[model samples]
Target: MNELPSRAHRPVRVLRVLASRHADSTRMVRPQDFDTELVAQAASVSDVDGHERYVPLCVDWRDARLLLSRWDDDCAMSDVPFLYQRQRRTATHLLAVPFEQLDAPGRAARMTPTFIFSIGRCGSTLLSRLLAAVGEQSVSEPDVLTSVAHFDDDAERAAAQGARERIVQSCVAAFEPACGPAPVIKLRARCNRAIDVFLNAMPHARYVFMCRDRDDWVRSSSRAFGDSGEALAELLKASVEAFDRMHAARVDPVLVWYEDLLADPVRALRRILLARDDLDARRAAVERALRTDAQEGSGLSRASLAMRTGDAGALAAFGARWREIRPERLLREHGLSRLR
Candidate 1:
């Protein structure tokens, strides 16, 4: 089991698990107090008003400790072994997300390595390395979160390939002994469900949320966005809405800014480390240099020379064209403020 690195959350408490029930055509095993507002959506099969019930079943020490995107995803019932398939699919993704995908699978370390994430170019990779340096364990990038965030459900058997359940269980398996022995996990932003999973499953975990100035973030992301990549722009707009909801919900998230973390990694990380009592005496420079021996280890870089100096100034022009942009529509669809 992973060791507890710092003073963190409590252990996983097994709530009651439910068994199978009837639904349109599927089955799910739900936990006792599963609480995601989103009802389990029906499969893509048309004309299906209800899904076959897949009742929630046993809560393994593993499942009880992993991060779940939404508790409700665990609640449906079906004979199709959807949950098992979900876990398998997640495993595939965990093995293939940009950096983490490259790691040799099933390595036998005493503890599981840290899996770091964020949407593309969100500096999650950099943060992962930082944690890796500080701890004895290695770090992987974009694990389950990115794959799920960018999942193409239209692709056949996406969930089955991902193995959603086992992947989550694996993370907790890694986290437990790692936290106890060397305190490895120091991951950054995952989709909302990732957060839900961590909070529900890993009580001894400390989650970190890294943020950037909206304008800078937008402009920075626009750097490599292709003409057809309007989804990139929409993602930023959508995140703003999500952030607002999280803030209103009064979640006490640890906020780390991209600029601050980059400008003076030593000092910034010192403060972050000092937030934990056991880490107060940890030197900033030592912490900064721990896993990340030097700059540019995170594999992040500016856009290609062509994109950086392209004749088309469309990205830069977003600054001046805000009013002309249909930001209102974007925010409305994303359930966010009309700050645009």
Candidate 2:
């Protein structure tokens, strides 16, 4: 039972909640509560984000449901429910799983050993798409690469295990022959660091390092994630450490630099084709990506010949930028940079 109040307050939605009755987990509250609350509210309201939210009697206990909101012009029973239909929310939280149970026991045979591991904010996504044109494979975002690979707590570990299994399922969907040509996985560089089981099973799998100019990367990063210098620095530092692992493993991977690709995308991609795959389909896809990516990355570089010529202001906007971290120098030093 829920109803809006006339307290001259900012707009907020109310949800009913309940804790799981089973006592396998000690924590009364769960992140799943947040997930369910959001889902249920979304069920009730059309513009959930625009409106502020509130839940009455939202204490640690049981019973929660989503309901539409209504305001009172002026009345005593404003917050009271029209019809009381409250019941408990979902009972199981993936967080309840133990750390030791994080890994999935499965016989996932290798179909491919190659992975496109981006050093955060690099053209990992673009490269992944380009690679998709080359081979039949599945693509994903920072997801498994971000939270799962670096699970700090038991809940995250459990989540990671589930995410890993889902990724495998994604691979199966991409190519019908599950273990035929092998599936190339694309993820952030740190994923390589945490995937012990994957590395052990697929030894031939090589990691492709996707790079971007430190400054341009920072610029793009700022647009995506604002004013978090400490977080950026920490992420960059972690990325460097992860790439370092690739070097220590003695894996001479395919390195695609951001600057080099932007400068002459076709030539750079042809070079990539020299080692990775010599098939015409792969080569053609790289060429197509070159044209498309050029349109997408038009003004990324200040020095690029193709900087927004007609719109002088856009070109000027990209002028004289530099990165706080000199990843190019570090790349060369760490042997993660490109070779002939």
Clashes of each: 62, 10
Model 2 lDDT, residue 114, Cα: 60
Model 1, CA-based lDDT: 0.36
The number of the candidate with the highest lDDT is 2
Best by TM-score: 2
lDDT of 1 by residue, 1-340 (tens): 2221232333322222232223211122222223223223222212222211111122212222222321234322111122322332221111111111211223223432232323334454455555444543433331333333333335522322334434444444433322343343433233543444333333333344555665555555555333223444455444444444444444443445666667765555555454445443545634555434222311123323234632245454544554455457545643333235
Local accuracy by lDDT, each model: 0.36, 0.41
Kindly give the stretch of ten consecutive residues in candidate 1 with the minimal lDDT sum.
Answer: 91-100
TM-scores of all candidate predictions against the true structure: 0.46, 0.49
Model 2 error, position 35 (Å):
7.9
List the candidate 2 regions with Cα displacement exceeding 4 Å. 1-109, 142-147, 152-181, 189-201, 264-285, 293-332, 335-340
Position 139, candidate 2: lDDT: 39
Pairs of residues at least 3 apart in sequence or in different chains that clash in candidate 2: 16-64, 17-63, 17-64, 18-62, 18-63, 19-61, 19-62, 111-182, 112-182, 113-205
